[model samples]
Target chain A: MNPVLGRVFPGLEGRSLRAAAVVTVLGGLVGVIGGESVVLALVLALAGSLATLSLRGRPNPLAEEYGLLPAIAALGALAALATPSLLVGLLAGVAGLGLLLWNAESARDTVRTAEPVEGLLIPGLGLAIALLTALSLPTASAAVGAAAFAVVVALALVVWALQGALTADPYAAKAL
Target chain B: MSGGSADPGPLKFRPRAVALFGAAGALAVLALATHNAVPLFLALPLLLGPAAAATGAPRVPLSFRVTWSSEGSRGEVEITGRLTPSAAGPSAGVVPTFYRPEPLIDRAPPEVRSEAEGIAFRLHWSAPYPCLVSVARPMLHWRDPLGLVERPVRVEGDALRLQRFPPELARASRAPLRRTTPLPGEVRARQLGGAGEFFAIRPLAPSDTLRQVNWRATARAGRMLANDFRVERTGDLLIVLDLRPTSLGSEIDARLASVAAAGAYGLAQSFLDQKARVGLALYTDFVESIPLASGRRQRYRLLRALQAATPGETAGPSERLAVSLRRYFPPGVTTVLFSALADDESTLVLPHMRRRGFPAFVLSPSPVPLLGQLGPRPTEDDERALRLLRLVRRRRIAEAWSEAAVVEWDDYWSLSSLASFFARPAGRRAAS
Candidate 1:
């Protein structure tokens, strides 16, 4: 397994493929809320898997190499806000976290994978979008969607944390 | 042996080395200021490439094992580590180093080398003293990319410990004899004559009984042959170990304990070699009582007694050595005592054994030289002090064993000294 970040989430190519599939699912779901849902879905889907790959260990791969990762995630956050409605943004956000656990039961080899940080960041970006859209519109649907998004992300966060704590840590010993 | 390099790998940045980065920054500044794109292009990647590569370097798992091999005081060890197979990214490695406080005189730690089969190496070591092989933690040399910085990553794994036990005498070169007991055994006795293991058959004498004649010989060319046999006597012996504290470091103290163990193991070994029944008992702190019996198991009894002979709290007076001997041991059974003879109680053991009617031999380890070897160096003043110390030590030893045959084992604790000591006129009579 990859030493720090990759140790938590290992299958890169498969996860990447899943991320694409998740984007299609997310896009169709968000389309119900209308207004740039396609773009929002794609961003959230990619960000969720990325967070799954990176966020688990200390300075997951994206955050470790350079400031490059934070920059990309921030850009995706900007894209999430462009969605027309808070409902669309919230749906995209919650979907990313839920999808991180979608196939999590079949723990994959983390050697070439990213960190698990994506689980938090994608939802965090969604949250940012929900706040922006909620403030701009102040509609009951926006408030309800924001509340639902917050609840889902909070639950996902707890489960992700508990999972990290429970995982059996296998150590490597080298001759000195 | 893997070559040891003091050069710190490129994980930490030194001022002199950091000057290159400073130089790169300066060139970039100079290029823009002088309107030249050449230096900027070159310096830009120089600044970014390593940081990028270090980030992307594949992280791999490494595992290791520490194994021990030994024969008496000398042996070798194998320490090997393997990286789990991976095709994810570029190769990386771990270099581990074992740590210790005191320098090993002739022993070297395993050299670390990363190989396809994994990193492994072997090292030979010789330490004849009793010790805990080691308790120090190991560390690994971790380097980032481009040999620019090196860091120490403390390696935490299941501890590897090779218990260093005192040397056990391997040869029964000298056999100590004991007085005859009722049990039938292998010790030959001069006074006791009976039907025994066949010694020889002679021509039938006129007075020879018909039952004593060998029928086969009578039937053959020989007219008659009287069967003759040597009386086989059983002897019982007990080895007493002193368990009082010693004034020395653990290593030397262990050596002293080992010396005591050597005496006990050797004596029991020698007697067992003669097929005489032997038992072992401890004092200062009372250990279990083992009854006398002749067989292969007696060796095991002696060894277990030696292990019990570890240094502990000072208990009964040295005279108890005799009291204990008298209480448990049978009359006429010879008692061999291994003690430092440094204390008042110990000083009385020899006379006690003699007075109790048990043939006694005392093997007391001389402490002065061993003290000098393990403790502080001896100067003229130190020598004078030692001489004073020696007078007291020897006086006490002499006081207890004044009328008894005592062998004061000195600097080189070996079997030859023991053999020769026992073969001396006094020791020979004591054995008989």
Candidate 2:
């Protein structure tokens, strides 16, 4: 196996590889939608690969030296600004934000099991994308009047109360 | 079940969590700078991940129970944890801190899997030579679902200690015993009037049996007489480990100390099996000794002492061991000194013990094998230097041999030669 590939995939098994593959497909999808330069695709691929390799506990000097992650985000923002289609910009933004979180998760001393993180992160990213897309709708934002704002505030208060009520008691120690 | 309190410290954000928050803040700032809503929307995923993880992170009480058993050199460990819905629960990724990489050997990484009740893993470890190995209580690692944070929960229990001796040392049961204590045992002693090989005739005592009466002696003397025989009793053995630093350096001394500890364990185990009272003395900056006694519990005590044996920074005078031996162990008890005999000070230890009336033996682990294994000589002149060093080592062993029986143990894997040396009668003082 190539050293680079070994570091990126680590036995070519586990959730990290699957997650990297998904990130790659999302990057490719964004590239097709934006009709941007090949540089965007290359940047996305590099970021995804770096994120995957980080899980193998190898020191990554390249990511640090070039600030590759922030650069990718900046490029995505620029691509979104340049493209004419709103859909392209939405996908680009989503991809950039998703890649940043992925890279952040990979930066650890040991390979992490994906069972716990995948279930939460995948849905969280999807929910964030959906929320962003819904909020981006001009008609929906205009139609929502003072009544919607009051409703939103009421829901927020209810969530806050629930969060407080659900907090576990620190005194209740359990043994295995 | 054993349990410990979870750390009461504030929640520690993973580096990635910090990075997530930083990325969110960076993108939000970029959105403000560019006067565009798209960049702001792009930062949502980054902000949402850590927020979700933090809100959902387990604060509910959790507990873990870890147990292990030795299957040859490998330890099979099982971990069971009680988890609330708030926690990520137990998984294969959670590992104890005691799992460390061994030098010179590329061990197979431990594989953990979810079992019916908990999780199980295998840890492969061994002492390449004879030595005592200790496993300390390890900290259990736990991570949140998003891998955004982690907590290290310490496992509470007694640490495991084991002694790995060379397989050849098991034959030490047949080792010759010259001195015996007052306790009755299998080995013959110098004293007469017991059920063993006949010695001479003596006037018949009330305790003398009809079979022990010597008719010829009785007829010649015209008086009642009985056959006397050598008594069978147990012996006292004191194993002393020389932990003083050597000229070879700390690294090599550590290797030598491991081999010596193993050798000491082998001798102690064999002697203890033969019903001999076995004690241990570790001579470092000061003499640390376990008093001589015979039983299963004494074996455990000696092993625990050996587990802590390591090479020391400074060397105590050879006479210190002799003085300690007189204070703790009985006089004329056969004392075996495990030393490399690398320096003249070590060479003098056996003689000092002998002067103090301990029948001393030196099981010197030769450092010659370690030299070859460490690496090749760095320069052409280095080879000559090593040769001169070998000559000096030989001279030291020779000096020690004059004082007591010295067995130069060059092999680390087996102790057949040492066992054979022990098998020979102790009256014949020779070197191998």
Candidate 3:
């Protein structure tokens, strides 16, 4: 397994190999719209294969911890696939954001309980955000796409911040 | 530990600076191209706002978390560490180095190796970045990076205090009492008797039945004597722990404490098996008395107190031991003192106990005798070197205790050894 691919799409290895395949196929479809589908498909296929291989023989705590992130991404992708409508895409985007928020809250609670739940959630959210961002671009104008990318980035930052802060000193004085 | 170097402060707002420079360059280019003001409009916010934010953003406080299993004499243990931006929040990029003060047996630098489980940072625009570190063994060290501006903060939490005691060796000494000694005010043969297995035989007392008389003894003595037998049950045992700071020399103080603790453990087990009441009186100069009762509950209570004991620096050796003995311990009980006997104070307490009618057994894990063979110098320049030497000496002292039946622990042994040593023989002896 190539370390680079694992780093790029952290929690999407394992059962999510199918998800990675779907993403690769979507990239190929994009290439079809622009007449370079073969090249896009090859690169995506390589990345997906590397990701799937990296997941083997490894305990995917990250996968379990952030299971909802991919689920939410899949939902968004399904919604986009169902209708190319701008409104539906926007609603799907909101749903992805909602999933991110849910994961963040779940991570915070897990830290409170001193459990390793965040291990799954962090990478799970990373994969979902990356996939959804890639999927949402077609329906949006350049400005809107940039804005959406910024929002996703901001959300990632928030998740990182929350994980750091929440786990820093999870238990209060009374709990100790 | 080396003092960490200074950090290159928060990152400069280079984007804003470039933007400002670009704006001026663009204005000049535009003027050269068409004498137009269009370039000025593009450069204003680019040069100012982001650069201002970059300069204005608060530095993220860097902190760390270190979690490991309990410490003991085990050869290997796993430790996990996490480095995160502190309460101020995540910044663009931050790397943390994990440090430990214990020995590590790995060739890799003391940095986390697996970024998958490593620290994850949120960079600008909320992108997640991960970093991993691997440690080969459990130890004590620190984590600090090249730049020290935002120093790594230590996350404090419960640390497992695993102190390995010395080994337990079979001792040559044995108890002199062959008969049970009974307490006064009880007339029943089972309740009132001397210490050990045998009771007594006397002329059939008013309450004694004819069947209670020992016919063989009566025939030999030619009298109607009743043989009364009592069960071996209650007796007193006292344990004195030496907490002098000097006693901690050469031995990892925690391990030294553990060895002393093991003696108390052995005594408690012995007393419990014999159905005798056992009491504990723990003391250092500063902490004079933590008197524990003799029973099932007291056994646990004593161990708990030993676990919490730490050597204080204030008192001299003799003064501390003397004060503890005088203030604590019940009168006339069998006393057992566990110490390294490194100082005069602790050694003198034994003779004092003897004068007071309590047979005090001194269990010293003193290293003075073994020090000559163990090393060349009294001290070393390296901190780790000194600690290792101390650990060796502590184990030597533990070995000395194992030689005496009254005490327990062999040199360089661990808590498990002490546990096993006392388990069988102590049980059998006490049951008898």
Candidate 4:
């Protein structure tokens, strides 16, 4: 993350306060340039890059990890900043990012997490998929497609990261 | 077989699978809609590179047998294992890893070779102290050549429990000896001088190693004559080890312990080679002893005793040795004590052992020489005190030599010098 972000914003490591500023400004500029609604796509791209970069060393990087998450995160970020209802758009984006954060940290935490949450997660995912298909039906608005993409990719990544965390036995790999 | 290959499982996909297959699909969808070459350029190699590079992998279960290397010793052992991998499975992955359990002995990582027969390597556990060892072989990742696909497959290597033995026995010197032990052996006896290396040719007798019937002597005597030889007598030897904790610091403590163990085992091996009944007593927190015995089995017992240190029964008091000796060893056994004698209890136990009628000897590694190997004591005062304490211990050992045998080896001396104690008699030794 440090090296990649360094190429984007000189002298700013991923951990720096200014890196967040770079992400915000880049996300907002992409939205403003791509005619308003594209801001959500830009947000999804930025968010996806952050999440995947953070999970660099994990055994298997998922399809959503490299492709859909970044796209979804960029779209969500744009929606947060450019929507008429800024508060609602920000809430939706933050909620979606929160889910991604949980997925990212899943590789580190599994023992204390509830198993029932996963059971519930499956149904919640099914409903989200149904909602996504419905949104794509009204493909006249690109925002709807971006929102559905964001929801589907975020759900898929959550499961993928959790399963990966459970399977990767770091101690067993070295067999020390 | 000189070498062989094995496949434990099937070929599996990795992230490049995502990149090659998943990314390619996404790029195709995007390219179809936009007719864009930019995305194709960005995604093509990202997807194809890993899958292509990984022509495939070898997934094979591995099995191995552990044995002593041809060039290893009783005190320092080297181990070699024949590791054979099973045939390639549905998928190809790397073999399960073998690692060092602990740094008890310094060793390189297990070396591996995949050949027609199997994978052969020496485990990093080469020459670890003789004990019950613990090793783990877990399933490992098998990635394609391009690393586009990876799968976790079960490792089929055997989990082995090995009883480590001393490296190799050193030959005993054939010099005449005066042994008082009641055990039978190849040593020349003190009083029972019959049935040995030809003392004289007499009339035929029983219990003679054939070829003892001297045909020439019998022809001259006009009678069937047999050879008489000095009786080969086996003596009882008690090798005492002191593994008590000391103030010399843990590093030096470990060094001295190794020296003590090596010296004890070396001397024991020499004695055993001469067909002597050998016994071992480890004086640590408590006394661990292997009763008097001879032969290869006894050697194994002695090796096991050397490494059988329990946390509670180790790194503690030294005076416990006196009590152990009183209870365990008979009074007349030729007892040899191997210790640094850092504590008064150990040094003091020496004279008492001699007084009890044991032909007691001390093989102590003097601490003064090893001080140079140490970085420094925490303080100058501590350093001064350490040297002083060792000097006092040396004086006490020197005083005991008149009543008993003593071989004081300098810790930093060469192995040949230390080994001289076994090749020759002690500087001052007396029959008990």
Candidate 5:
């Protein structure tokens, strides 16, 4: 790692944060390529960068840190507006938001311990994306429509809450 | 990894958490109004981030045990400790932030090593100068997984206070004690007729004891002869540190003061070891003196005073040392002065001390040599000006020799010369 970049992302010492960064970039690229909007790609990339910056340099609160989540959400909304397929836009936006949040959370404090938070977050996010993709597929039967989509969303939320409670290793949580 | 960073205190909700929820809510409202699932999906992570962080909040209170010890004056501080949670619970790891004040130069932070028992860390802080430095106990920054909450717990321990000075100073006991007080001590006084080093054999007196009779001397004299030994009584040493500001400027004056303090500490320690009554007088705007006393308590007192001395507004007249001496010390006490003798005023103090019956020895840490290291001269004219300044300083010190004994101390680091100088009488020392 570059010394300058190392200082900016002190949490990068762990593999989890590096993986989060790679995942966020890949997700952002997928959304931009799928939607065919270069502008959305740049905006999503900026959002990822902003979230990363929030956890940078000595764990003190950055002046622009609070704007991170809102900025990512706004970028997602823009992606939605640009794409013809709502599902594609949603997947891309969700992927960027999820990965960036993971990256930020992986380094929560300055501790350099392995993150169990990633275990809980990554699986929950993967399950949500998979269910959403399955429901939105055109090959789906007529029975799996808006009603079915709502049911699946509710089930995913329940699974997410259950997963958080069960997989929660409170002691395993370490500093970046 | 530097310990100089600010402390991130106790567990509290971060604004980022509020922003995450707020953004999530706004996106959700937009999704409902537009009847679009895309905006709703965008809100998922932001909402879940804080939600998951909330669930994983630290349940057990965290604390740490930190202790520090210094090897020597030049050695680094060895800090070791372990982190402990209030209950057998969360395996969450926390980074403890160490506080590094000015004069502490190390860049590396404490390295944490987890053992079978708990999380332990070790740190070493190398101080570069002979001065006092205090490092605060480390603060454990316990952060929730998603960084939604932060709690900085101060470790249970006192701050590490390290007083570094030259170890050679312990040899200050070898310094000669020419003058002596009436009190009993280790060094031999000039007077005869006591149980000490042999002085001379004299005709027997009526009160002389049989043990005092030197049989060989009596046989040579063909009469009763007695042995007269020098009295082994202690001496009163008043170490005066001239803190008065000189023309050398505050920066040089501060360095000079530091040097003087180190020198004074060594001399005091040496003399105190020989059972001499050592007192201190810091001659600043007025005068502060530690009354003449002996033993370990006096050594501690002198050390405490030297550590506290700082350079600032000190321009006391030369007469203050003399007048203060009369009040706090005996009239004919042996006085050792630590001064830069940077100006005429500084040189005058020794004469004042001598006039008042106090035999004085001036250890002048030369400011002339120090000025050379400050930096290069800007131009030839500046170089010429510095030369003239040096000449003037030389003349001032030369004039001071006519009054009291003076030793020009050019080198700051090496105290061997000063140690040898202290062993000899003021009359024998060559003028600076």
Candidate 6:
């Protein structure tokens, strides 16, 4: 195994074969669920399958470390296709949201470990938006749900906008 | 006491503050619509925005750790760091930062824009959520990127102390005529005759007691030649290290000290290998002494002591070394003083010890060109400094004695130079 790839995705080389098998089964399931829309399901499943396979040989340890993000997205997308009911769609949406939150948390940990701060404003606001969106979606009407979703999307955009500004300066610690 | 001692079951997260502000804004808006009250709703975001921002903040728990290889070289060492988040909610997804502040011996600090591999995840959903994030880097240095706030964390680890010793003469080529004066309790070699102080006479050889042996002289010489031998016992050697702040400059001083310490350590090891007893003494004006002792254990102790020696303000050249030396060293033991010939105060006391017949070897670190790079100086100051340094060099040359050996180490190139110089068969034959 390439040292760089191994480093980027610890244990990924070993799991590549397993990941391929699981992805194949998941892809077939997606195709079965699409029914009349076989071509669309096949394409999405192929995209997800390729991502999973490509992650197996990612040459950067960080890329491998973050490989879970795409995997989670693919799984959520697959679940949404497999069961098109509102409940299943909601569950898939929640799962996708959970994966995104997980990705954000991982990114935050990477930042905090490298550079620590008293509080993180962007991520906090993002979490707030997610919580409010999730809670209001269940209790309120479609219009209210849409409003909450808009707020969540807006917060995500705000956080994304602040990424460059929030980048911790390497020499900032030495300033004091 | 009971009321005060009662536990506040895990801190509550209340939305009342947000609700109250929202209510007040709603009332203000209603009043505005009815034209009855002040417009307070305009302040809603100013008040509730920061409060909501504060509430949503992630409490990240950070710690630093440092580790190095056992080998004494400043090569690449793996740095492992972990950052754990203590809050759940959306805050658990935050990416923490890591960095190494000090420069490693072999490798320079990694490029500023480089990124590290890290994992962040929540361990549980409890009140204080613990999220763990781990990262590894070839060299230690990193930072965290959380918007609006940044924290710096440093990890302390084992620091490798790389040292190389001055080379010595090979044993095979070091042979020289052994000189000794025989006394009542001295060990003797069965040689035909000897020179120097007299010893008891035995029967003369066939080629012996003739012309220069007069009747009285022959009587004294008997049948044997009047042979003498000096006592051949290994002497105790004590190495004294002066760690005064004034003795060194900030940058090169520590390296100078380390070099001197390493030299003394190497020489002591050589002496021990030659069956000599070795001891060590470290002194500064404030810290009086680390007493001298002899043996393998003492050698290890001295190395450790040397490692711990730090320059301080209280120590200077004029400080009395005799008081400390007298307290720890045995009478008439050979003493080696390792110092940077920086101040005249230390030079003042050297004559007194020489007067006492102790062979004092002064090993001075040769000042190098690195000092010039440390800071800017006037051209006149540089010229004056060079002139003063030359005078000091002359003084050291003038002060050289039969019992003293002064060695100046100016560059890394000089170690092999000196070793080769001393190891020459010609020098050994000439000295003998």
Best by DockQ, which number? 2
Candidate 1 lDDT tens digits, A84-135: 4445545544443333233221222222122333223433443454456455
Name the 10 consecutive residues with the lowest summed lDDT in model 1 chain B.
B1-10
DockQ of 1: 0.01
- The per-model DockQ list reads 0.01, 0.21, 0.03, 0.03, 0.16, 0.05
The C-alpha lDDT values of all candidates are 0.49, 0.60, 0.40, 0.49, 0.62, 0.42
- Report the lDDT tens digits of candidate 1 across residue range B1-432: 122222222345423124335544665575556543233322332333233223322233222333323333422223333332232222343444444322122254334445554334333344343333332434544433232333543344454444342223333323345554544554563322226677777888887777778899777845777777655553667777766665554555556776676567666665576667788777655545677876787677666567556676656654566667767778677777777776665666566667776656777776666665534555787777777878888777667656566777664334455566656776667655
lDDT of 2 at B400: 81
Among these predictions, the greatest lDDT belongs to: 5
- Candidate 3 Cα misplacement greater than 4 A, ranges: A1-176, B1-234, B244-251, B255-263, B288-292, B310-316, B340-359, B363-408, B411-432
Q: Which 10 successive residues of model 3 chain A have the least lDDT summed?
A: A107-116
lDDT of 5 by residue, B1-432 (tens): 222133323456677677767776887687667655555556666666655555444444555666555563343555565665533434454655666654555435456665555566665555444455456666665655555556655467677766655566666554445444544554544445546778888899999999999999899889999999875654667888888887778878876777787678877776676677788988888888899887889987887788777665958778877987888887777677888878777777877887887768778877766676445436777678779878887787788878777777765555566556656664343211
Candidate 2, which CAPRI tier? incorrect
State residue B101's C-alpha deviation in candidate 2, in Å: 7.9
Displacement of the residue A61 alpha carbon in candidate 1, Å: 28
Which CAPRI level is candidate 6? incorrect
- Choose the strongest candidate by TM-score: 2
Model 2: residues >4 Å from true position, as ranges? A1-18, A21-36, A40-85, A93-118, A121-176, B1-11, B73-98, B101-106, B152-158, B178-232, B374-392, B426-432
Worst 10 residues of 5 chain B by lDDT: B1-10
Cα shift from native, residue B122, model 1 (Å): 4.1
Better structure of 1 and 4 per DockQ:
4
lDDT (Cα, tens digit) per residue for candidate 4, span B1-432: 111233334555543244345544565466445543223322333333333323333323423333223234332434465534333333222343433343235344344444455444554334433333434443344443322345555545454434333332243223233455554454544333345655766778676556777888888989888777665765677878777767767766665665566556666777777676788887667777888877899987886666453223245444456657767767677677777766655566765666655556676776666664446446777677667767787786777666566656663223444345455654323322
In terms of lDDT, the poorest run of 10 residues in model 3 chain B is B123-132
The CA lDDT at B215 in model 5 is 98
Residue-level error in angstroms, candidate 3, position B208:
27
**Could you tell which candidate, 1 or 2, scores higher by TM-score?**
2
True lDDT of residue B157, candidate 1? 47
